[model samples]
Target: MTHPFGFNYGGKTHYFVFDSESGSLHNVDYVTFLCVKNRLSIPFEGGEAEDFRALEKEEIDEINAELDQLASQGVLDSPCTVTQKKKRTGEIKALCLHICHDCNLRCRYCFADEGTYRTADKAHMPVEVGLRAVDFLIANSGKRKSLEIDFFGGEPLMNMTTVKAVVEYARSLEASTGKTFSFTMTTNCLLLNEENRKWLNDNMYNVVLSIDGRREIHNAVRKTPSGADAFDVILNNALEFRKIRGDKSYYVRGTFTAKNLDFCNDVLYLNDCGFDQISMEPVVTDLPDLQIKKEHLPVIFKEYEKLAAAYIDRRKNKDTWFNFFHFMYDLEGGPCVVKRLTGCGSGCEYLAVTPRGDIYPCHQFAERKPYKMGNVLQGVSYDRNVSDVFAGNIVTNKPDCTDCPAKYYCSGGCVANNLNFAGDMNKPYDISCAMMRKRFELSLAIAAIEACEG
Candidate 1:
């Protein structure tokens, strides 16, 4: 009973359960649901045993089948070989380089706190630092034949020269080192033009174009330092970039703040604009205006429903698709088989290097000492105590997550998010937890539908 969790939906309260123990998802009718509920409420001793014997044979058989399945899934405290949590067995597989600490656009809901993290003057990462970051990733990638390098920043495109230099140097190392490199760049599209498009098309593995959906939505929050609108420029660059990017190695990444609760149209808007791969995420912040409010949850849910329908419509039409969270789910397990109890590769397999070569656990923790791992030049020589603390942050260490059915799938929530909202890395973000629950419910339903159809 501990692992099989689900929700009732549609008319007459049809019940669906996700059996996490065996990774099985199935539905139970009203009578079966009631029988299971009643039996769990009472101990099967003297009184409960008599009550159970009074039930009809068919009902008892149905209830017994449910119990057997639940027992098989280890829900009834049945003894079984517990799946142990895994540590990183591989080397550094991915690294995010904060190529610049300054951005040209003045996006209102920027989690980077308007580029400088609201602390100091803006600066760009020099070529030397970027090159060292590339080297650091290569050197520390141990035994892993392939590595992913992400060029992140206040605006990665602002330091085009540094990006080009790093890519070229990385490519130069590939032949001799015999390591395959997958390069990605995240940009606001404010700086994209003919030359930049050509360079990205030629060298980059993929470009994440940051545009907040429709023209009005994009202009409302995402703007230039001079208060100029970003919609026109972003659209223009995306069109040109897409022309050379016929293979579709790019994703239109957007953000939806509290203001844009009904943002489903934005996905359709991007689709109409000829962009297929799209990701629209709710803005993660505690700021009043930007944060997703409780009232906005329903609207967001509806929006996701609409987006899912649109995705199905696209598939039917033999057209492109807007890849969203539900699109990532399969009956086998949402995305991938997560061996570790943790949700992400923050401090273990991935490292985030700041402009000055300051190393952090991940991109969100960049410039923050609390999550600092090591500098690029010095390598990821983490402090013993800090390393131990992060190592213990898996689901087994988190009391709340230990009982959660979605623990294996949710990346145990983001460390940076926890530290930001609750002032502690071990603390959880309750808001995001609700969001994850809704997402899991939707994903489970999609998985059920697909399973039935197939």
Candidate 2:
């Protein structure tokens, strides 16, 4: 019912319409915007309506007719639904390999249990294990010529030898197997020394550097085991890495929590740090003091608005511009219906391999024994019940998402988060859902401003 979202942004100089049904943004004049937004005759009256005083009845009627025509074309709030493609079966396209279940930093929000992943012994993935994982991806790829391998971990660089071996092995088979491999690594960058940074720049398709914003805020939660400041080292290394990386894809990723409700400043700080591509995510945790509650939504929403306004300013002034990951919405030719319906293809097309070679739905579900699909050595052999559950929990199948205004935009959100919060994959975490909806609105608004300004 909310397909066409109408709003005023950019200090109210821009009135825009976002057609979610078609993934289109339209920059509209005041009269037309008012017609679609009010869904009735004009509301202007008195001296405040002076600018529109000369608009004849016939002009108003004509604008109404145009709006009606747009609605019928599914570029407005059309009743028609997008057809969901049949559920995908076996064709793994991406793998997150846990290179090591160990890390150098002791981040307070470390979900991997300070690098052990809840395991007693922090272990580095054996070189053979990493090689086997590459082979496993190649063998089960099923016509997927371009495959993705993300070297993930408590810290992937901890197992540099294994990572290099896997990449080399995967590359060795490219010509013979008629397949190509792209690599991505997510690291804290403490180990991004000269040699390692050079090698990563040459091989990785993308690199994710972890740093919280502002020195004080970052050092508050993220530090070395010896309780020393970890921010400076990581920041310096990230800058160095970016200098040599040329134009390849990389982002400085940060996390916001209850401690940092005023997170907009952190985002701006990252932008000022010379990292052009950036992502700032809310921390997902069960720790009561750190959890984002309903009361925090208003503050968070306000921060988002501040960010959006800054985004608009940056877009207009190119010198201070940076890409905020959450706001990067492709309004033209987005993913197909199947991709939208199935979310990230976590348990299906994408799976994570732990340091021990065990496969799980994704990295977040790595140590959870019940979700284990199988191991790289044996291939995917596990309970059909788990697979069926994953296949059935598409956006269309999720009761909560079926009628949501942002269903197609978010695709039912993160499955792991849903499971952890709502205790069901089909049920979304309300906090995340709210944040996502607000982000979608702001993203559309930002796009609308750009479209109009251009």
- The number of the candidate with the highest TM-score is 2
What TM-score would every model get versus the actual structure?
0.86, 0.91
Candidate 1 regions with alpha-carbon error over 4 angstroms: 1-15, 27-57, 60-63, 66-70, 73-86, 332-342, 378-385
lDDT tens digits, residues 1-454, model 1? 1333333333233456555544556676644544655655633443545565577888778777867877765655344233555445335778888888899888888889777755586778888888888787777788888889899888998888888898889889999998999899999887899999988888888889988889999999988889988799889898889878987588888898987887888878888888877888788977798898777787887777666556655744536655664356765535555444545777777778888888777888777777666676676354445545666666655667655657666756888888777677777787777777677766776556546643
Mind sharing the TM-score for model 2?
A: 0.91
Which of the numbered candidates is closest to the native, going by highest lDDT? 2
Q: What are the per-residue Cα lDDT tens digits for candidate 2 across 83-148?
A: 563357577789999999999999888878887889988889999889888888887789999999
lDDT of each: 0.73, 0.82
Model 2 lDDT on a 0 to 1 scale: 0.82
